[model samples]
Target: MAYRQGVTELLRILASAVTALLVAAPSLAPAQSSQPVLEISGASFRPLPIAIAPPIAVGDEAAAADEIYEALTFDLQVSGLFEVVPRKAFLADPREPVGPEGIAWTRWSDVGAESLVKFEVTKGAQGPKASFKLYGIASQRLDLGSTLEGRRADARRIGHRFADELVKHFTKEPGAFSTRVAFVKRAKNSKEIWVADFDGRNAAPVTDRGGISLLPAWSPNGAELAFTFFKKSMEYPNGHPQLWKANLGNGRSSAFVGRGDLNSGASYSPDGSKVAFTLSTDGNPEIYVVNADGSGLKRITHSEGINASPSWSPDGKRIAFVSDRHGTPQIFVMDADGGNVERLTRQGNYNQTPAWSPRGDLIAFTARDERIVFDIFVVDVATKEVKRITQDQGQNEHPAWAPNGRMLMFSSDRGGKKSLWVSSADGNVQRKLGLADDGEYTDPAWGPFTK
Candidate 1:
């Protein structure tokens, strides 16, 4: 009966298009319709054929142009929607196009490209200026267009914005380009929290607490981060980790919820008004909810065993967490006020670290099988259907959702070293963050879109 009620509610929301609908403000047309994209029901979604010409440089800025080109190509390809045509197949010299009027649509169409995108980067005294145009090959009608400005060192930033706009034109949802992913990186014997560009290009430490700093959770605005800091102190000689918050603006941090006892994971509500965390002052770890200002503390879970990893639903109506109350750690969902408790993972004997998607369609978590190997799994909230997102990949855990809900960032030891990896929700394509960097990463939390 509960499953039926949930399914009916989901269908009603789906019929009205109540959720997963993004405004078309970034779309260059300014009036793009609210049509849907390929559903994520494991449908054989078609990738649009799009040829992107190498970005042209104004006044001999080849490196800048190339960097911009790379960023754009990566963004579109990783999106899992657009099929980027090879630049080697571009029949028209990108530089030959003085403007959109000079595009050789026939040549692009000959190469099987359904659409084409062109961009020009100009380095000026004010910094760098970028202009782009998207056009349909056969129709010859401009699908979208936009201009952006940024510093020469901000090539990746500008490119991400451009890619997001392009995605908006096609999917109506903004791409994950403008977002940042906060992760924990290890150096020597110390673990520090670091924040980087979504694609893991510009990475820098957010904390230098020396001994260890883990469990980084970003504020909804991405301007602040809450983490657990551990260090040697007179009272805690062995080391103790207490919850702390850091301001990304000035890199300044202050104690957040230092209960002077064992405290664990923290997550912000969708509206950033409340925080759900696991505390164990009563000798039994239980999930608790508190105001963002650290007030109105209340307990959400009364499980006798360990209860941790509270992931709040995007609507802030539910919380998905891990509990071993039934003798085995499993994924469970409960209301924000801790009512109508329901078990979500039935088959798996061990499932933990559940991260609810931003779109609220699925909850991704790590599950251990009979072999004692860990992998990622996603469960549909309405249908109670379970799908494996990772398998046999060397110990995949901690699946965090990008702000757009189109991609997931998780930690894995597939390459002999622990690092953060990104993939679509269905686990179709997986890649290492930063491509070549050899940094040990964990506890990745994707921040909100650009401020």
Candidate 2:
């Protein structure tokens, strides 16, 4: 689609406050600790200042331990919750103070650190074991402790699990680090579905079909994905797009809806028992739903122009979709049973791709403002109050919400290259994820929380 374009500018932004290590001033004493100031109130959030000590090399595999060290550091940093103390300023050795009780709490206070995480990762015969010790600077006490065990190849997953724990301890909400993102990556001459870690690591192709793929949607169970795929040939010289589903675990891809003259935007229902998609078998695109098995087909919208991108509400009571029934693309909400239709987004004439947050509190979508720039915006489903997320930051589209509703990942051309960026759900603490390759990524879909 022409709507998909390369980003014209580069801009990196995050609203969460995180600062590096700072030595305590002369006025401070070893017994004194920093006050707890990190809290989330409404749309505003304050990043906490925290320090981490390197894990001691456990065996002859000290070099191997480096992977865990780097992965852990990257997870916490991208979390946008803490200002990590630089390694050069790390006053404490990873070997000493193995236990919190044997440590000098004043050292962190002296370095102006408010919170701390001291961990030891060891590769053993069984697997890798990471011992994490959490602390509060205000009291110089151990707040929590846990052990994570994973296979050697699971080093990154281990780090993500540990980072999420820290975020949970401080924010009272689960972190999004453990999740993954699925998107369309441009390869050679075609685009295909690809999935990567929350930090954009381990990116690999999910489909080998040499064609154009877009708008991936993960099933609520995270076991399958549905997306729009187009393969041009004599049968489809002009490109006939169809909706297809893939078994993410087994690498199976098959069309679920192609009878329509044009099929795209396949969104699974909250219950995972049915799917809502846009089908244009009648020469006019309209919203439709069918059983998970592709049976019990039912049309949800009747319009002359277009109605696509059907996003279901969390409760399964309603669906927020895009339609041009009013002359311009705008967001609309209708009952799950197809009744009581009402327009939800009133401000923008060019609004589309409405993604309802898992928490059911907000709906994020893309809109082209009067300035003729595409940006991301979120509307409170209850109050209908709209909030702008990305303004003048290259074309930002495809806002996908993390399962916890704490973060959102979208595709942007912030640096003149179309790549995925993750940000706090409220547009705070944004960071561009560096995927494995330089390939442009688009239409990211944040998957559900993994077990």
Candidate 3:
């Protein structure tokens, strides 16, 4: 009953908005009688053209409005669902009102925008409040709209929230813009673990103790991170990598598995109760599983060749890892207890960093082609069909799937520097994430959607 009531109210709002537009701008073309179904995923998908008008700042909200606008624009462009129209081609005045009566629908149409977005920022009781509206130009309908209030310092988050809502309107699944991404940013003497927004904004170091922390993996609930820390002062005191856990709340960390000669590639189980990692306590590297608290340690793989990069399946019944037992490092899947081992990738001779999709349908990984250039690829779990996601984009590696499995984040040298980049699941849309820091970013771990 509540769902129906919300839909009824949305229809009423759209009716009022469209009626005002038609009456105020009668010379415009009549609204289309029908709308096309949008396909945001799959191979047949085409990006929808949308126009995001300049934000209308009210009172002293000009700065906050600009920040929100920039964030919203970036999210839309990188979403792979919409092709944002450049503001330089806009024919309408920039100061136009967001109300339906004042919108120049014909101008937006001339600019080849099927949908239009209008944002308004006002001073809220505590900080800044924003109002967002999405209009279907052809149908003259209000497709989506929301009003949100947040701290002025978090204006960017307000924009992210609106973008998530917009994506949900079209795909029924919310966007991953509000999520965080953990990555390794290499410094002169240390490779520190850092966390930032999905788009690489508001980055802050998670570990500042001046050592190397690699392969940052988020717990399913996002309350903690599992990584490999290398330091000479640990129990081993040998500077060997050891699995560690960090509480994101208090920024405290402790070794999770320190007895092994080397422990790395920590992948949290779906339920966040366990972690599967690679340990070299034996003569060679092998996949191992341990409880989240470092108890019940068990080796999962026993192979002559190295076995590493253990990624748990969504159902927790299987684990995907990399193995060179067949003479080439390739993706392999085995039961959680290391039974029924089966090779998953058959093409590339050098394939590693297999990231299981949250949907459990695909596993994204990095491979070196015949030309020795690294690229991202995904293999279907059922069909074993491999699809290349990046090509000729410089070296790209360490693919990590978003929580919804609709997108992936990896590191790329495409811009002449190694940085974080994100792409759609089908590789149709790709964009480089913007980070202010000047250093190589790698091993990107896209966190789960925030509460």
- How do the predictions measure up, each by TM-score? 0.88, 0.86, 0.90
lDDT per residue, candidate 2, 178-232, as tens digits? 7888999996888999998888887878988887888999998999999888856
Residue pair clashes in candidate 3: none
Best by lDDT: 3
Relative to the unseen true structure, what is the C-alpha lDDT of residue 359 in candidate 2, on a scale of 0 to 100?
92
- In terms of TM-score, how similar is model 3 to the real structure? 0.90
lDDT of 1 by residue, 1-451 (tens): 9999999998998866744343311233423333334343456677778888877788867777788888888887777677788888778865666354666667889898987788887876657788888776665656677888778788888888999888887876778888888989987888988888988888888888777888889889878898878756798897766778899999998776767466668899988888888887868888888888788889888869999999999999999999998899988999999999898888779899999999998999999988999999899888889999888889998999988888889999998888888887677778777733555888999999765
TM-score, cand. 1: 0.88
Question: By TM-score, who's the top model here?
Answer: 3
Residue 107 shift from truth in candidate 3, angstroms: 1.8
Worst 10 residues of 2 by lDDT: 12-21
Please say which candidate is ahead in lDDT: 1 or 3. 3
lDDT of 3 at 365: 95
Quick one: ranking by lDDT, best first?
A: 3, 1, 2
Candidate order, TM-score descending: 3, 1, 2
